[model samples]
Target: MKTDADAAPLPMLYRLYTAGAQIASPILDRMARKKLQRAGVSKARLHERAGVASQERPLGKLLWIHAVSVGETLSILDVIKELRQQAPRMTVLLTTTTTTSAELASKRLPEGCIHQFAPLDTPAATKRFLDHWQPDLVTFVESEIWPHQIASVHDAEIPLALINARLSEKSLMSWGKRADLARALFGRFSLVLCQTDPVRDGLRAFVQEPWKVVTSGDLKKSSDPLPVNDLQKARLAQAIAERPFWLASSTHAGEEEAMSAAHKHFVAQHADGLMILLPRHPERGPEIADMLRTEGWRVAMRSKDEAIAPDTQIYLADTLGETGLFYSLSTLVFIGGSFVPVGGHNPYEPAHMGCAILHGPLYANFAQAYADMAEQEASMEVADAAALGQALCALWGDDEVALLQANAKFYIEASRNIRKDVAGHLLALIAP
Candidate 1:
């Protein structure tokens, strides 16, 4: 399987890889089992990870989408819904790597669409899975790649499209070193719709094709703001009773201490101000709780059934799939991963919610999105706790908050056509 481009030579290392998989299958299987230790796989549907199906294949052109996690899954929801509406006969199959993603897909996927755990990336498992599902067209979101699965799909002459495709700076440099391997993998895609020009350039250097690749715009920009429960939102609003609040969402390891200190600084100036801190990984909730408590903050853990009391300084929302609720309650929302070197989580989610988006200096992961926001004056990039605290204090007034939110709304409106645009190109490719 090849595109009509001058692809770099396929690497000799690929054959060695599959051959190695053959010998190390047992060890790999054990690792796969260990992955489920944290309740990521359902006991009833556990076989799905082993390339066994619990549901029979639906008859139609199955447009299979493989997105790795909650972010990727949510980003493509609008695209999938548009495609399903445009071509009613198209049955959608969405697969994710994590149990949280699978649970999310079950709730969010459109009617008639199926959600399943992705099969393990070994030849036997992938073959068993693909042979059963027999997807007509396969799409991968972001940068998830499984060598054997990709090869098997191409071997069966499936049309592959990579939507909102991206590679980090580190990934691009590493792949450049292994040009032969890069070409072997990237060349198999019939189309690669990259998020930015630089990403398109990096892919072009490997596949060496202009025709198969194009800038599709970021799919996330078009997704609906993460959903919030209206009743819960109303209750939270009443309980707080017009208190000034800001959210530091999806905080990672190093940034936790800084954010806690920042919250304390702001609270010193504004007595009733509160900070709702949400960790990126809920599993680290305990560690964050311990750290904040030790630092003398009145921390209330969501997992422990603690609510935002009148005296509660830091409200710790330590659970899955609840970021949307907090996004709805606050206008000044700081996306956390940027504060440290962990790249950044998607600020677009908050931007779409019309947040007065806040970030630290480091935000390479979603750099283009942040740049767009900054250009519109829709967001603020703070350097440290002092800056973040001061900004929060200044923005507590109604007029300033409204102004920032207006800018965010403008940014969202300016960049919304990507889902429809990308869906049109995808439908064209998959059309019979």
Candidate 2:
């Protein structure tokens, strides 16, 4: 089914040489080892085989789903849940790249599903992993396209699909330069379900196979908000009782500065206000705390046994997998990574927790969902740092917090059932 255009020579030798250089670098080797150690605990559950591994071999056709990180792993939880309910006997093998994502997936995936840390993309490792698992169907979440892995699956005659498929503008440009290579890589997928029309068009430039490509709304929209534990919720509620608090969730590098500035401005008016800044990567906790401390702010880190004192203006929630706790405690929440060039993180978590949502301008990744929320007045989009501070201050001063909460609730209700549409299509593809 591949076109003549796809048969062009690839930069395979160059790519192999580049990969060898990276592998030979001592720094990269150490980092890879550390990453493997962190993610390998669950990965060991699988039996190693031809460039792949079997996590759990339930007696039936195995359906393998691979998602790289926290966002992608969380986005597909609902689909896995639905699949379990519909086919109790079906074995699902889930793989993730990061330790945090693996932990999250293990906690959420149903009993029939097995979790593993996906092997590093080296040909030997990929081949060993595939040989062990021997999946009948393979579904990749988001844009994690491993060349050798996909090619291996294709060679084995396994049905392959790319779910919630997305290609960023930056990625598109890079792939555009190697159109033939891209075409060969993508042509391996039996189906390619894109998140948006832009993604579809972007993919079409490299992949001319029209029958395989189609658009399905983002799978993240269909994801259920992570559940909150009663004990944790109660403890957080007590900690935040009657205090004016807002959450800066999933903050990236530059975003913390913007958030700290906004927090300072908000606290100037309401002296007792608190800001909970949750960095996207918890490893940056100590650095963020030091940054805020240098600015004469009393910052308390979650990892430390520092109590939330009355004088504490900022609480650095540098813990992993606890966004729900912060969102539940907040009256208003700002989803970070939007202020800087990094695409926005999910806004649905705050909406599900009944928190008034605020974001910055560059949310091209989830533009449609954000657009809908903004149009319905369920969320607010600020122009820049100053506007973000102003919006937060205004929301804090408003007496009817119920209005904001209601807007968030309405948005969540309206967006329900999107997962079912995506799941239905996937089921049809995998039908026996």
**Span of 10 residues, lowest total lDDT, candidate 2:** 1-10
lDDT of 1 by residue, 52-135 (tens): 777899998888899999889889999999998888888888988787787788888889799888887877778878989988
Output the lDDT of residue 312, model 1.
87
Clashing residue pairs, backbone N/CA/C < 3 A, model 1: none
lDDT of 2 by residue, 152-236 (tens): 6776777788999888888889988877678777876778899888888888766557767888877776677766677877876
Residue 179 error for model 2, in Å? 2.0
CA-lDDT, candidates in order: 0.83, 0.77
Clashes of each: 0, 16
Candidate 1 steric clashes: 0
Best by TM-score: 1
Model 1 ranges off by over 4 Å: 1-9, 33-44, 398-400
- The window of 10 residues in a row where model 1 has the poorest summed lDDT is 1-10
The local distance difference test score of model 1 is 0.83
Off by over 4 Å in 2: 1-56, 120-123, 208-211, 399-404
